[model samples]
Target: MATTDDSFNGLTEYCDECELDTLHEVSVQIRTESTKKENAQFSREPYRVSECQRCGHRTSQRMNNA
Candidate 1:
């Protein structure tokens, strides 16, 4: 079997519903938002969203802003 750095290689994460660490499918996404100022400063943020392969629970968090 071949493996890369992604979660496809049987990566496991904590799932709230499952209540135990389980395999999770992870994905990357960008979130766009503007600061609450007169001239709003728009920004694009990256995040890793993961879903438990067994229970369908989601765990998401913003990644380091690059």
Candidate 2:
């Protein structure tokens, strides 16, 4: 399970419209992992859609819940 205190430090990517790399503000976040697994130690796959804080450019990415 992911923690609330998880760091957002290394989660940035390039924004084409902004013409620079900027931190994005998360617009939507969804967890796509099954909760009915036999083992309780399974990982999670989170889908996130964010917008560039500088130019309002939108992007989507899948995050590893390691």
TM for candidate 1 is 0.65
Q: Write the per-residue lDDT of candidate 1 for residues 16-66, one digit (tens) a residue.
A: 798787887778898766666654445667888887779888767899855
Q: Residue 56 lDDT in model 1?
A: 83
**lDDT at residue 50 of model 1 (Cα atoms):** 85
Off by over 4 Å in 2: 1-12, 31-45, 63-66
Which ten-residue region of model 2 has the weakest summed lDDT?
A: 1-10
Whole-model Cα lDDT per candidate?
0.70, 0.61
Which residue pairs collide in model 1, if any? none
lDDT per residue for candidate 2 within 1-66, as digits (tens), equals 111223363245577898776666664475545667664345455677777767778877677645
For candidate 2, give the lDDT.
0.61
- Report lDDT (Cα) of residue 56, candidate 2: 78
- Residue 33's C-alpha lDDT in candidate 2? 59
- Model 2 TM-score is 0.41
